[model samples]
Target: MTVPFYMCCQYVDGKFCFVLHEWCAKLPLKVQHHVVHPAHTFFLLPKIPSKFFGVFNCNICKLPSNGFAYGCTMCGIYVDINCAFIPKEITHDAHPNHLLSKVKPLVKLTKRNCKACNYPMRFRWGYDCTSCDFYIHLDCALFLPRVTKHKCDEHTLSLRYEPAENHISEYFCEVCEDEFSPWKWFYHCTRCAQSMHTTCVPLILQCEKSRMTYDSGGVYNFLNVKFGGTLEIKGHSHHLTFVQGLESDGRCIKRRYVLELSMIFKCLEFALMDQIDHFDHHHPPSLVHLQQPSNKSEEDDDEDEEKDEDADNFVEEEHHGGKCNMCNEQIWSFHLSYYHCESCL
Candidate 1:
């Protein structure tokens, strides 16, 4: 798929000129009360601290960072610079009565969850109201885009926290027809009264016109080009230079977001994978996911609630080769990525 032309970078003379993404350039040099260690101030660091073990983990996004970050060494909290922009307080539609404050992980034992969605606060990342006792995962928070338009509705759909009180029994998603929870956030057209899930809001079908289908046959990872560096891919003949998403660069957002959203449904993917080390592999094997083709289109492309099941079924279908001693999965590694022993992989 084509990179949003805006990401091509303005005021740049060359493709590898070490320019920052437009969104990256706008981040404040210093931030406070908005990251992992909210009380401490986070400074934009050019390099990760040496005190961190072999790999530096961002407590905010729960992702590893080899590039730029906002860090608070005092409390040992480093965050992916992109996620640091998340506001400490946000007004979400799911609860219109109170502005939900951001919830983060604490050092000691803490118990919390999203009252809606039934997902627990594993990363301890969410937006919540203490007195009202409301909580929602950061994954849900990311879906709350203020406004969007789709072909299903004749007019623009405005995001609403709750459905109309005067609604009929048919207050369900126009796209999926699943009955929506009254307190759950959704998109609605005032003129048509049609409602849709916030996660189902990608009407810009640019891929159809371009004749591109996002599958599991692409190099997928969190591309960190915020500082403009080069990385040599394993077994590749040459060193690969980092570019922040380019149209011709061959990296797809469908791969990036699908893998990212897996954390929403299955928090166990990385939480258990990262801490363990195999005898053959020094680094944790990265998890990658490509969006499946839905009836219409994408942001993470397709698979959402069904991702966990689809992935399990894919692994079960692999019987072409001998199994790895580590996990007993088929020894196949071409385009698809799986968490397995590097030597066997």
Candidate 2:
């Protein structure tokens, strides 16, 4: 048998206290016989502070904020409800030219790699090209702009690359803020004691192309950049040899680090399903898939044989084995990147 709950109330001075119902009469405390049953046992809790219920958004991830919140509401400041707060400005010696910027949602629908992570920048909120697709997380892109002159003797370093070399770095690039000795086709500034990875140079280019610039030395700098092969890599000196046809491992490292090749193939499948979207706007609508060979391949050894088999299997499955999920047309592996049909995407 369970006991019913009741609440009790007390009255003072002169008149007898009143019980609203029989349940109140049976409460725990019977002060001056005023106690009611389960009703009297109820406890009253103190009111809580309203400030404890404020909100914020995650500074790193940009999720909804919670907990003891304090921010500029007028500027839409917020953070995740349960995350710890971080400082806005970071100080470093390597990047003395400018302070780092904190941001998120660097790019959208990009099938490329991130210069910092050496992986695909997909579905992540991190530091990014304010104007273009280049992106980096706060923790990753953190660097102190160089202040003093570099220790190297060959070049008189400047914060900016010289125009004579076509905007290319004059010395070695320091990856992960490592010590620089000798490297080619890399950017360096002896005067500023600064160096950057060759891959990082592309980031500057993309920023320039997008016409995006941030405050550099109290001036609102623009992305006015040009590129020429002037610097040389220490280990891989041949990097500067084949200008246009350089087989860069950076691309491979990027895909391998982030999304697997299977995902790329999956994206290809999605592309085939929606080939029309990838088509040139000027060209007449022809049900053809434009094939752009992938830059890197994981299964290089079996790629040739597996591709043929996959093509056959795709044809059999799409044409008769299974329905095209996009437009209900029959498709096969041969029709992987480009699917032909009215009903397909």
Candidate 3:
């Protein structure tokens, strides 16, 4: 990762000169600063490394770059690089009917406040726009529901800007499996009067992706929670099943999902470990095992004793060991299970 450049000021030719610096290595050079009047803005002059100079005013902040320069992509709207990568879209449950878009300068559009959030889409990066004009904060936009499904519920829930008089007022989320008020952004089962929290929807979407490998009925919801049922994708022979489980009511389904995600992570961990082992042949297996995830639970009664023994074994084994090809740590066993530190790896 590159360290951020900083702005600095120095007195030169009886005047304070602004400049961009690498944040370290004190160096200053004299140069002309770009100052756009009418706009009353200041900018750094473009120069190659060979002709580099010191302190210059940042055209964006009206202050020095603390010694570094940042180029803005938005047509001369320069800002520090740190502030450049804002999210473009957000779908918030607070305003279900709309997906929010960030405000863009130089674009003319009528602004409207969110009926649900009472937040103006024109202000603070939130604005309501038609095909003609659109703007809203990224977080505010997330409230809209992109899709709906029924699972262990009754009334059908659809994403709407406002609720109807006869609409079901409360239901449980099939994803988090939690009960919530229907007024909130949620998944509603029209048949059973069921609903799901807005936050639960994204997690449920992940389960859908993973379901592609399983067949209907073959993938059980352990907790007897109902689903929208299985799906048969085009170009595939097998059916896929998924269950949205709310906590408190769908314990079995929750556990199944957790187990599945944990297994996936474990597989990734092993792949990483294998790569490390191949690169460092001389590292002892025991040291590598220390870096690997523990199969035994932390609550195991023997954990403390095992840890003490392992430490003792490591020290003794290193007493007359060959140097590790990676870290300087002593080799403990010939079955090298080298674990790479995240930074080094």
Candidate 4:
């Protein structure tokens, strides 16, 4: 059988390997000139025979390549299409001042860590700077797109190649609910405050997009019927009761029960605005209230705890000139009634 020109394999190390013929022909003149392997130039191989081929691996990525490879016949160096197409030099938003050049690490330091992902550099191909200690993995530098859309969120997420200085706190992926490494690339949606890992993007995209209905009457009915019961939210010690039609005083409530109810109402309002649909088919929306402890012993214990706390505060005020615990500011006579800092509270 006569093989098509695009399907023709190149002989290397007495073995045939596959390569994308069209991809090689479309390479820019600048990339073609900068040969990756020093001893010999690499050529595209159309296909690798299924049988009698010893284990062949790409020298750049150190991964096995069976199809579509760029290889050198004399030096016996091979690389997959993705690794072979790495640009000679790249200007990333993370490092704008100087362009990062693609270079192989010294044989002695073959296991240096990548600065971009903080992962060990097992791959032979990477972008780095000779002047500085900046080094990034080949996959990290080239695998992501600037903007991408996923069904998990409504807003388009932009890829953040580098960590922002202001984002010091650890970030979690909205899709996987796993902690994200600051050194690795992640997608962020500013409007929704959503961040996700590149690996989780495909899984999120596969999920069915949630469609919400915004009829006020329907929402009212849903809230009243389906979600009226008490809910146990994670992290909160108390059970919350969803309340309906509570009037807001337009100011923060000081009472604990009132405050909890107010917060739940605010969340419901926000959900209404966003037109979020509840998964429970049987329940309706309602207001949340904290269930009071029924046991008299527990209530007495609470009173004792409050008295002890008040006694400690009295001692602290006498010794420390009634300083605000949060801000460490001296309390004035007029403000002595308020124990907490107004802003902190």
Better of 1 and 3 by TM-score: 1
Best candidate according to lDDT: 1
Predicted candidate 2 versus true structure: per-residue lDDT over 228-265, tens digit per residue: 22334455423332111111111223333322111111
TM-scores of the candidates are: 0.42, 0.21, 0.26, 0.44
Give residue 151's lDDT in candidate 3 (0 to 100). Answer: 45
Task: Name the regions of candidate 3 deviating beyond 4 angstroms.
Answer: 1-124, 128-139, 142-157, 162-169, 205-345
Stretches of candidate 1 off by over 4 Å are 1-58, 61-78, 85-99, 106-112, 138-143, 151-154, 164-183, 203-345
State residue 35's C-alpha deviation in candidate 1, in Å.
4.9
Please say which candidate is ahead in lDDT: 1 or 2.
1
Error of 3 at 94 (Å): 11
Lowest lDDT block of 10, candidate 4: 211-220
When summed lDDT is taken over every stretch of 10 residues in candidate 2, the lowest stretch is 260-269
